[model samples]
Target: MIIPAPPAPSTPWPLPRIKLHIEDLDHEGAAIFQGAVNARDALHLAVQASYRWLYTVDNPPPKVTQILLILRSMPGVAHTIGTGRDGMEKEIHFSLEYIVHSKARATAEIMGVLVHETVHCYQHNGKNTCPGGLIEGIADYVRLREGYGPPHWKRRGEGAQWDAGYETTGYFLAWIEDTYGAGTVSKLNHCMKNKSYHKRHFKDLTKCSVKKLWNAYCCLLKDDDGAKVLEILSARDDDD
Candidate 1:
Protein backbone atom coordinates (compact mmCIF):
# COMPACT_ATOMS: atom_id res chain seq x y z
CA MET A 1 0.00 0.00 0.00
CA ILE A 2 1.25 3.46 -0.82
CA ILE A 3 1.43 5.76 2.17
CA PRO A 4 1.85 9.50 2.01
CA ALA A 5 5.04 10.24 3.92
CA PRO A 6 5.36 12.75 6.74
CA PRO A 7 6.76 16.25 6.32
CA ALA A 8 10.51 16.67 6.09
CA PRO A 9 12.34 18.24 9.01
CA SER A 10 12.76 21.97 8.34
CA THR A 11 15.72 22.78 6.08
CA PRO A 12 16.78 25.54 3.73
CA TRP A 13 17.43 23.26 0.75
CA PRO A 14 14.73 22.27 -1.66
CA LEU A 15 12.84 19.11 -0.59
CA PRO A 16 10.62 17.05 -2.82
CA ARG A 17 7.30 15.59 -1.76
CA ILE A 18 8.03 12.12 -0.38
CA LYS A 19 5.97 8.94 -0.64
CA LEU A 20 6.37 5.34 0.51
CA HIS A 21 5.11 1.97 -0.63
CA ILE A 22 5.79 -1.50 0.72
CA GLU A 23 4.82 -4.47 -1.42
CA ASP A 24 4.07 -6.70 1.55
CA LEU A 25 3.99 -5.18 4.97
CA ASP A 26 3.99 -8.64 6.56
CA HIS A 27 7.29 -9.61 4.96
CA GLU A 28 10.15 -10.07 7.39
CA GLY A 29 12.31 -7.69 5.38
CA ALA A 30 9.62 -5.08 5.70
CA ALA A 31 9.60 -5.55 9.47
CA ILE A 32 13.39 -5.27 9.60
CA PHE A 33 13.33 -2.16 7.47
CA GLN A 34 10.84 -0.54 9.81
CA GLY A 35 12.87 -1.45 12.88
CA ALA A 36 16.07 -0.21 11.25
CA VAL A 37 15.02 3.34 10.60
CA ASN A 38 12.03 5.62 10.63
CA ALA A 39 10.87 5.74 7.02
CA ARG A 40 10.16 9.46 7.00
CA ASP A 41 13.38 10.64 8.63
CA ALA A 42 15.61 8.33 6.64
CA LEU A 43 14.08 9.46 3.35
CA HIS A 44 14.44 13.07 4.35
CA LEU A 45 18.05 12.50 5.32
CA ALA A 46 18.60 10.86 1.95
CA VAL A 47 17.44 13.94 0.06
CA GLN A 48 19.30 16.27 2.35
CA ALA A 49 22.49 14.27 1.95
CA SER A 50 22.49 14.94 -1.78
CA TYR A 51 22.01 18.64 -1.21
CA ARG A 52 24.44 18.70 1.67
CA TRP A 53 27.26 17.37 -0.46
CA LEU A 54 26.37 18.47 -4.00
CA TYR A 55 24.75 21.85 -3.61
CA THR A 56 24.78 25.21 -1.88
CA VAL A 57 22.17 27.89 -1.17
CA ASP A 58 22.90 30.05 -4.22
CA ASN A 59 23.18 27.04 -6.59
CA PRO A 60 20.44 24.69 -5.38
CA PRO A 61 19.34 21.32 -6.65
CA PRO A 62 17.11 20.96 -9.65
CA LYS A 63 13.38 21.02 -9.03
CA VAL A 64 11.95 17.71 -7.95
CA THR A 65 8.26 17.79 -7.09
CA GLN A 66 7.96 14.31 -5.62
CA ILE A 67 9.94 11.16 -4.87
CA LEU A 68 8.19 7.83 -4.44
CA LEU A 69 10.09 5.14 -2.54
CA ILE A 70 8.97 1.61 -3.32
CA LEU A 71 10.16 -1.36 -1.29
CA ARG A 72 9.67 -4.79 -2.73
CA SER A 73 11.26 -8.19 -3.26
CA MET A 74 14.05 -7.55 -5.76
CA PRO A 75 17.42 -8.95 -6.79
CA GLY A 76 19.56 -5.86 -6.46
CA VAL A 77 19.90 -3.23 -3.74
CA ALA A 78 18.17 -0.10 -4.99
CA HIS A 79 17.95 2.36 -7.87
CA THR A 80 16.30 5.71 -8.54
CA ILE A 81 14.46 6.67 -11.71
CA GLY A 82 12.98 9.89 -12.93
CA THR A 83 9.40 9.09 -13.84
CA GLY A 84 8.61 12.51 -15.20
CA ARG A 85 9.80 13.67 -18.60
CA ASP A 86 10.64 17.02 -17.12
CA GLY A 87 12.52 15.25 -14.29
CA MET A 88 10.23 16.48 -11.54
CA GLU A 89 8.99 13.14 -10.15
CA LYS A 90 11.38 10.36 -9.15
CA GLU A 91 10.92 6.82 -7.91
CA ILE A 92 13.45 4.98 -5.80
CA HIS A 93 13.01 1.23 -5.72
CA PHE A 94 14.66 -0.50 -2.78
CA SER A 95 14.98 -4.24 -2.52
CA LEU A 96 13.34 -6.10 0.35
CA GLU A 97 15.52 -9.13 -0.34
CA TYR A 98 18.68 -7.06 -0.07
CA ILE A 99 17.39 -5.58 3.16
CA VAL A 100 16.82 -9.01 4.69
CA HIS A 101 20.30 -10.20 3.80
CA SER A 102 21.85 -7.31 5.74
CA LYS A 103 19.59 -7.66 8.75
CA ALA A 104 22.53 -7.62 11.14
CA ARG A 105 23.59 -4.16 9.95
CA ALA A 106 20.27 -3.03 8.60
CA THR A 107 20.32 0.53 9.79
CA ALA A 108 23.55 1.63 8.19
CA GLU A 109 23.06 -0.44 5.08
CA ILE A 110 19.58 0.90 4.53
CA MET A 111 20.66 4.47 5.03
CA GLY A 112 23.65 3.98 2.77
CA VAL A 113 21.56 2.60 -0.04
CA LEU A 114 18.94 5.27 0.47
CA VAL A 115 21.53 8.01 0.35
CA HIS A 116 23.20 6.50 -2.71
CA GLU A 117 19.96 6.12 -4.61
CA THR A 118 18.71 9.52 -3.59
CA VAL A 119 21.71 11.19 -5.20
CA HIS A 120 20.40 9.93 -8.52
CA CYS A 121 17.25 11.87 -7.74
CA TYR A 122 18.94 15.26 -7.87
CA GLN A 123 22.37 14.97 -9.56
CA HIS A 124 22.78 16.44 -13.00
CA ASN A 125 24.09 13.91 -15.57
CA GLY A 126 25.76 16.28 -17.98
CA LYS A 127 22.76 16.00 -20.23
CA ASN A 128 22.99 12.19 -19.96
CA THR A 129 26.48 12.24 -21.44
CA CYS A 130 28.45 11.84 -18.24
CA PRO A 131 30.43 8.65 -17.98
CA GLY A 132 28.40 5.92 -16.26
CA GLY A 133 31.19 5.31 -13.79
CA LEU A 134 31.43 9.00 -12.89
CA ILE A 135 27.68 9.13 -12.25
CA GLU A 136 27.88 6.13 -9.93
CA GLY A 137 31.03 7.55 -8.33
CA ILE A 138 29.29 10.79 -7.47
CA ALA A 139 26.44 8.86 -5.87
CA ASP A 140 28.80 6.80 -3.75
CA TYR A 141 30.71 9.97 -2.89
CA VAL A 142 27.67 11.22 -1.03
CA ARG A 143 27.30 7.82 0.61
CA LEU A 144 30.94 7.89 1.73
CA ARG A 145 30.70 11.49 3.00
CA GLU A 146 27.74 10.66 5.19
CA GLY A 147 29.93 8.06 7.05
CA TYR A 148 27.70 5.26 5.85
CA GLY A 149 30.50 3.48 4.01
CA PRO A 150 30.37 -0.27 4.60
CA PRO A 151 33.00 -1.85 6.82
CA HIS A 152 33.88 -4.43 4.14
CA TRP A 153 35.05 -1.72 1.76
CA LYS A 154 38.70 -0.72 1.86
CA ARG A 155 39.64 2.73 3.01
CA ARG A 156 42.39 2.88 0.41
CA GLY A 157 41.79 4.53 -2.96
CA GLU A 158 44.22 2.41 -4.97
CA GLY A 159 44.43 -0.23 -7.72
CA ALA A 160 41.75 1.42 -9.83
CA GLN A 161 41.33 4.14 -12.42
CA TRP A 162 40.14 7.51 -11.21
CA ASP A 163 36.77 6.99 -12.87
CA ALA A 164 36.63 3.41 -11.67
CA GLY A 165 33.80 4.90 -9.60
CA TYR A 166 32.53 3.99 -6.14
CA GLU A 167 34.96 4.68 -3.31
CA THR A 168 37.88 5.04 -5.70
CA THR A 169 36.48 8.13 -7.33
CA GLY A 170 34.75 9.21 -4.15
CA TYR A 171 37.92 9.32 -2.11
CA PHE A 172 39.68 11.09 -4.97
CA LEU A 173 37.05 13.82 -4.93
CA ALA A 174 37.37 14.05 -1.17
CA TRP A 175 41.10 14.62 -1.55
CA ILE A 176 40.41 17.34 -4.10
CA GLU A 177 38.11 19.03 -1.59
CA ASP A 178 40.63 18.75 1.22
CA THR A 179 43.61 19.82 -0.87
CA TYR A 180 42.13 22.47 -3.10
CA GLY A 181 39.47 23.90 -0.79
CA ALA A 182 35.88 23.36 0.19
CA GLY A 183 33.30 23.36 -2.59
CA THR A 184 35.70 22.15 -5.25
CA VAL A 185 33.51 19.17 -5.99
CA SER A 186 30.44 21.36 -5.79
CA LYS A 187 31.86 23.59 -8.50
CA LEU A 188 32.58 20.56 -10.66
CA ASN A 189 28.98 19.45 -10.19
CA HIS A 190 27.58 22.86 -11.08
CA CYS A 191 29.61 22.96 -14.29
CA MET A 192 27.85 19.80 -15.42
CA LYS A 193 24.46 21.38 -14.91
CA ASN A 194 24.42 23.21 -18.24
CA LYS A 195 27.12 21.67 -20.42
CA SER A 196 28.13 18.29 -21.75
CA TYR A 197 30.72 16.31 -19.83
CA HIS A 198 34.35 17.13 -20.64
CA LYS A 199 37.72 16.57 -19.00
CA ARG A 200 38.43 20.28 -19.28
CA HIS A 201 35.97 20.88 -16.48
CA PHE A 202 38.65 19.66 -14.08
CA LYS A 203 41.21 22.08 -15.52
CA ASP A 204 38.78 24.96 -15.47
CA LEU A 205 38.41 24.53 -11.72
CA THR A 206 41.92 23.41 -10.60
CA LYS A 207 44.19 25.05 -13.22
CA CYS A 208 45.69 21.64 -14.00
CA SER A 209 45.07 19.06 -16.70
CA VAL A 210 43.11 15.99 -15.55
CA LYS A 211 46.11 13.77 -16.41
CA LYS A 212 48.51 15.80 -14.24
CA LEU A 213 45.89 15.91 -11.49
CA TRP A 214 45.38 12.15 -11.52
CA ASN A 215 49.12 11.49 -11.61
CA ALA A 216 49.80 13.87 -8.74
CA TYR A 217 46.97 12.35 -6.74
CA CYS A 218 48.26 8.81 -7.33
CA CYS A 219 51.79 9.79 -6.29
CA LEU A 220 50.51 10.57 -2.78
CA LEU A 221 49.16 7.04 -2.37
CA LYS A 222 52.66 5.50 -2.72
CA ASP A 223 53.89 7.27 0.44
CA ASP A 224 51.08 5.93 2.66
CA ASP A 225 52.36 2.32 3.06
CA GLY A 226 48.86 1.24 1.96
CA ALA A 227 47.37 2.43 5.26
CA LYS A 228 45.45 5.61 4.42
CA VAL A 229 43.71 6.31 1.11
CA LEU A 230 40.79 8.58 1.80
CA GLU A 231 43.24 11.44 1.53
CA ILE A 232 44.82 10.08 -1.67
CA LEU A 233 43.81 9.59 -5.28
CA SER A 234 43.81 6.81 -7.89
CA ALA A 235 45.86 6.25 -11.04
CA ARG A 236 44.28 6.66 -14.46
CA ASP A 237 45.03 4.18 -17.25
CA ASP A 238 43.64 5.84 -20.33
CA ASP A 239 44.87 2.93 -22.47
CA ASP A 240 42.43 0.65 -20.72
Candidate 2:
Protein backbone atom coordinates (compact mmCIF):
# COMPACT_ATOMS: atom_id res chain seq x y z
CA MET A 1 0.00 0.00 0.00
CA ILE A 2 1.26 3.48 -0.92
CA ILE A 3 1.63 5.97 1.94
CA PRO A 4 -0.84 8.88 1.82
CA ALA A 5 0.63 12.36 1.88
CA PRO A 6 -0.81 15.30 3.78
CA PRO A 7 -2.63 18.03 1.83
CA ALA A 8 -0.58 21.14 1.21
CA PRO A 9 -1.64 24.48 2.58
CA SER A 10 -2.88 27.06 0.10
CA THR A 11 -0.78 29.96 -1.07
CA PRO A 12 -2.02 33.48 -1.67
CA TRP A 13 -3.41 34.10 -5.12
CA PRO A 14 -2.15 36.82 -7.46
CA LEU A 15 -3.99 39.12 -9.84
CA PRO A 16 -7.75 39.67 -10.12
CA ARG A 17 -10.60 38.31 -12.20
CA ILE A 18 -11.57 40.64 -15.07
CA LYS A 19 -15.21 41.07 -16.07
CA LEU A 20 -16.59 42.76 -19.20
CA HIS A 21 -20.01 44.25 -19.94
CA ILE A 22 -21.08 45.32 -23.42
CA GLU A 23 -24.03 47.70 -23.67
CA ASP A 24 -25.78 48.71 -26.90
CA LEU A 25 -25.12 45.50 -28.79
CA ASP A 26 -26.91 46.86 -31.85
CA HIS A 27 -24.36 49.65 -32.18
CA GLU A 28 -21.86 49.42 -35.09
CA GLY A 29 -19.10 49.67 -32.55
CA ALA A 30 -20.23 46.33 -31.19
CA ALA A 31 -19.70 44.76 -34.60
CA ILE A 32 -16.26 46.36 -34.77
CA PHE A 33 -15.52 45.08 -31.30
CA GLN A 34 -16.47 41.54 -32.34
CA GLY A 35 -14.09 41.87 -35.27
CA ALA A 36 -11.25 43.50 -33.33
CA VAL A 37 -10.77 42.17 -29.83
CA ASN A 38 -10.72 38.84 -28.12
CA ALA A 39 -12.32 39.99 -24.87
CA ARG A 40 -10.66 37.52 -22.54
CA ASP A 41 -7.18 37.98 -23.96
CA ALA A 42 -7.59 41.78 -24.11
CA LEU A 43 -8.46 42.07 -20.41
CA HIS A 44 -5.64 39.76 -19.45
CA LEU A 45 -3.29 41.87 -21.51
CA ALA A 46 -4.59 45.03 -19.87
CA VAL A 47 -3.97 43.68 -16.37
CA GLN A 48 -0.53 42.56 -17.41
CA ALA A 49 0.19 45.97 -18.89
CA SER A 50 -0.71 47.62 -15.59
CA TYR A 51 1.47 45.29 -13.53
CA ARG A 52 4.43 45.25 -15.89
CA TRP A 53 4.74 49.02 -15.80
CA LEU A 54 3.46 50.04 -12.38
CA TYR A 55 4.17 47.42 -9.75
CA THR A 56 6.19 44.30 -9.12
CA VAL A 57 5.18 40.97 -7.64
CA ASP A 58 7.12 41.84 -4.49
CA ASN A 59 5.11 45.05 -4.09
CA PRO A 60 1.46 44.43 -3.40
CA PRO A 61 -1.01 45.65 -5.99
CA PRO A 62 -3.95 47.68 -4.72
CA LYS A 63 -5.90 44.70 -3.39
CA VAL A 64 -8.24 44.90 -6.34
CA THR A 65 -10.80 42.11 -6.00
CA GLN A 66 -12.33 42.40 -9.48
CA ILE A 67 -12.24 44.66 -12.54
CA LEU A 68 -15.34 45.17 -14.66
CA LEU A 69 -14.98 46.63 -18.11
CA ILE A 70 -18.16 48.32 -19.31
CA LEU A 71 -18.24 49.08 -23.03
CA ARG A 72 -20.98 51.56 -23.78
CA SER A 73 -21.83 54.57 -25.91
CA MET A 74 -20.06 57.24 -23.93
CA PRO A 75 -19.00 60.80 -24.70
CA GLY A 76 -15.29 60.25 -24.08
CA VAL A 77 -12.83 57.56 -24.98
CA ALA A 78 -12.67 55.80 -21.61
CA HIS A 79 -12.64 56.34 -17.88
CA THR A 80 -12.41 54.28 -14.69
CA ILE A 81 -14.24 54.40 -11.38
CA GLY A 82 -14.21 52.49 -8.13
CA THR A 83 -17.76 51.35 -7.56
CA GLY A 84 -18.29 48.68 -4.99
CA ARG A 85 -21.37 47.31 -3.34
CA ASP A 86 -18.84 47.56 -0.52
CA GLY A 87 -15.50 49.10 -1.68
CA MET A 88 -13.31 46.50 -3.40
CA GLU A 89 -14.96 46.31 -6.81
CA LYS A 90 -13.83 48.45 -9.77
CA GLU A 91 -15.36 49.35 -13.11
CA ILE A 92 -13.85 50.74 -16.30
CA HIS A 93 -16.02 52.36 -18.96
CA PHE A 94 -14.82 52.27 -22.56
CA SER A 95 -16.58 53.91 -25.45
CA LEU A 96 -17.74 51.47 -28.13
CA GLU A 97 -17.77 54.21 -30.74
CA TYR A 98 -14.19 54.97 -29.85
CA ILE A 99 -13.33 51.36 -30.52
CA VAL A 100 -15.09 51.41 -33.92
CA HIS A 101 -13.21 54.45 -35.16
CA SER A 102 -9.95 53.03 -33.80
CA LYS A 103 -10.27 49.80 -35.77
CA ALA A 104 -7.08 50.61 -37.63
CA ARG A 105 -5.19 50.36 -34.33
CA ALA A 106 -7.62 48.10 -32.59
CA THR A 107 -5.26 45.96 -30.61
CA ALA A 108 -2.74 48.56 -29.56
CA GLU A 109 -5.01 51.55 -29.11
CA ILE A 110 -7.53 49.58 -27.14
CA MET A 111 -4.82 48.14 -24.97
CA GLY A 112 -3.34 51.60 -24.45
CA VAL A 113 -6.59 53.16 -23.34
CA LEU A 114 -7.39 50.17 -21.18
CA VAL A 115 -4.01 50.37 -19.51
CA HIS A 116 -4.46 54.07 -18.83
CA GLU A 117 -7.87 53.57 -17.32
CA THR A 118 -6.68 50.59 -15.32
CA VAL A 119 -3.90 52.66 -13.84
CA HIS A 120 -6.52 55.05 -12.58
CA CYS A 121 -8.31 52.13 -11.02
CA TYR A 122 -5.17 50.96 -9.21
CA GLN A 123 -3.16 54.09 -8.45
CA HIS A 124 -3.85 56.23 -5.40
CA ASN A 125 -4.81 59.89 -5.65
CA GLY A 126 -3.23 61.29 -2.44
CA LYS A 127 -6.52 61.32 -0.57
CA ASN A 128 -8.22 62.72 -3.66
CA THR A 129 -5.95 65.75 -3.71
CA CYS A 130 -3.53 64.83 -6.47
CA PRO A 131 -3.54 67.20 -9.38
CA GLY A 132 -5.66 66.02 -12.29
CA GLY A 133 -2.77 66.64 -14.70
CA LEU A 134 -0.41 64.51 -12.64
CA ILE A 135 -3.04 61.81 -12.35
CA GLU A 136 -3.53 61.70 -16.11
CA GLY A 137 0.21 61.98 -16.62
CA ILE A 138 0.87 58.96 -14.45
CA ALA A 139 -1.64 56.99 -16.50
CA ASP A 140 -0.08 58.02 -19.79
CA TYR A 141 3.40 57.57 -18.38
CA VAL A 142 2.63 53.91 -17.92
CA ARG A 143 1.12 53.81 -21.41
CA LEU A 144 4.10 55.53 -23.01
CA ARG A 145 6.58 53.43 -21.05
CA GLU A 146 4.84 50.28 -22.22
CA GLY A 147 5.39 51.43 -25.86
CA TYR A 148 1.78 52.40 -26.50
CA GLY A 149 2.41 56.00 -27.53
CA PRO A 150 0.15 56.80 -30.50
CA PRO A 151 1.20 57.97 -33.98
CA HIS A 152 0.49 61.67 -33.47
CA TRP A 153 2.62 61.91 -30.32
CA LYS A 154 5.54 64.31 -30.37
CA ARG A 155 7.66 65.45 -27.40
CA ARG A 156 7.00 69.15 -27.13
CA GLY A 157 9.06 71.53 -24.97
CA GLU A 158 6.50 74.33 -24.99
CA GLY A 159 3.56 72.75 -23.23
CA ALA A 160 2.82 75.78 -21.03
CA GLN A 161 3.77 73.67 -17.99
CA TRP A 162 5.18 70.30 -17.01
CA ASP A 163 1.98 68.95 -15.49
CA ALA A 164 0.02 69.43 -18.71
CA GLY A 165 -0.97 65.74 -18.39
CA TYR A 166 -1.35 62.94 -20.89
CA GLU A 167 1.59 62.60 -23.28
CA THR A 168 2.92 66.04 -22.52
CA THR A 169 3.63 65.29 -18.86
CA GLY A 170 4.24 61.67 -19.76
CA TYR A 171 7.22 62.73 -21.82
CA PHE A 172 8.39 65.01 -19.05
CA LEU A 173 8.19 62.14 -16.56
CA ALA A 174 10.00 59.95 -19.08
CA TRP A 175 12.76 62.52 -19.29
CA ILE A 176 12.93 62.52 -15.48
CA GLU A 177 13.24 58.76 -15.41
CA ASP A 178 15.97 58.83 -18.02
CA THR A 179 17.94 61.60 -16.37
CA TYR A 180 17.65 60.27 -12.86
CA GLY A 181 17.35 56.46 -12.95
CA ALA A 182 14.92 53.59 -13.18
CA GLY A 183 12.17 53.42 -10.50
CA THR A 184 12.04 57.19 -10.50
CA VAL A 185 8.51 57.24 -11.82
CA SER A 186 7.59 54.33 -9.59
CA LYS A 187 8.82 56.20 -6.56
CA LEU A 188 6.90 59.23 -7.69
CA ASN A 189 3.74 57.17 -7.95
CA HIS A 190 4.35 55.55 -4.61
CA CYS A 191 4.97 58.93 -3.05
CA MET A 192 1.61 60.09 -4.29
CA LYS A 193 0.00 57.11 -2.67
CA ASN A 194 0.64 58.78 0.66
CA LYS A 195 1.25 62.51 0.27
CA SER A 196 -0.01 65.10 -2.17
CA TYR A 197 2.08 66.60 -4.99
CA HIS A 198 4.34 69.49 -4.17
CA LYS A 199 6.91 71.16 -6.39
CA ARG A 200 9.56 69.97 -3.97
CA HIS A 201 8.91 66.41 -5.07
CA PHE A 202 10.51 67.11 -8.44
CA LYS A 203 13.53 68.69 -6.82
CA ASP A 204 13.82 65.76 -4.45
CA LEU A 205 13.63 63.24 -7.27
CA THR A 206 15.39 65.00 -10.20
CA LYS A 207 17.55 67.43 -8.22
CA CYS A 208 16.02 70.23 -10.29
CA SER A 209 12.84 72.18 -9.96
CA VAL A 210 9.97 71.47 -12.39
CA LYS A 211 10.15 75.02 -13.56
CA LYS A 212 13.82 74.56 -14.32
CA LEU A 213 13.15 71.34 -16.16
CA TRP A 214 10.44 73.00 -18.21
CA ASN A 215 12.77 75.85 -19.05
CA ALA A 216 15.48 73.46 -20.20
CA TYR A 217 12.98 71.53 -22.28
CA CYS A 218 11.70 74.69 -23.99
CA CYS A 219 15.28 75.71 -24.83
CA LEU A 220 15.89 72.35 -26.48
CA LEU A 221 12.89 72.90 -28.78
CA LYS A 222 14.14 76.32 -29.83
CA ASP A 223 16.61 74.51 -32.08
CA ASP A 224 14.28 73.62 -34.93
CA ASP A 225 14.24 70.50 -37.08
CA GLY A 226 15.18 72.13 -40.40
CA ALA A 227 13.25 69.60 -42.43
CA LYS A 228 10.07 69.97 -40.33
CA VAL A 229 10.31 73.80 -40.38
CA LEU A 230 10.48 73.87 -44.18
CA GLU A 231 7.71 71.31 -44.46
CA ILE A 232 5.40 73.36 -42.22
CA LEU A 233 6.14 76.56 -44.18
CA SER A 234 5.54 74.77 -47.46
CA ALA A 235 2.28 73.37 -46.24
CA ARG A 236 1.15 76.80 -45.05
CA ASP A 237 2.00 78.39 -48.43
CA ASP A 238 0.14 75.61 -50.28
CA ASP A 239 -2.99 76.39 -48.21
CA ASP A 240 -2.62 80.08 -49.07
Cα lDDT of model 1 by residue, 122-227, tens digit: 8988998888878888888788878888878654444668888777788777777767777788788898999899988887887665665666667677664333
Spell out the clash pairs found in candidate 1: none
Error of 2 at 185 (Å): 0.4
Score every model by TM-score. Answer: 0.86, 0.82
Clashing pairs in 2: none
Q: After superposition, how far is residue 71 of candidate 2 from its true place, in Å?
A: 0.7
The segments of candidate 1 whose C-alpha lies over 4 angstroms from its true place after superposition are 1-11, 155-158, 225-240
TM-score of 1: 0.86
After superposition, candidate 2 runs with Cα above 4 Å error: 1-13, 224-240
Q: Candidate 2, residue 220: CA error in Å?
A: 2.9
Tens digit per residue, CA lDDT, model 2, 110-190? 878987888887776777788898889889887887777889887877746778889888887877776577667767777
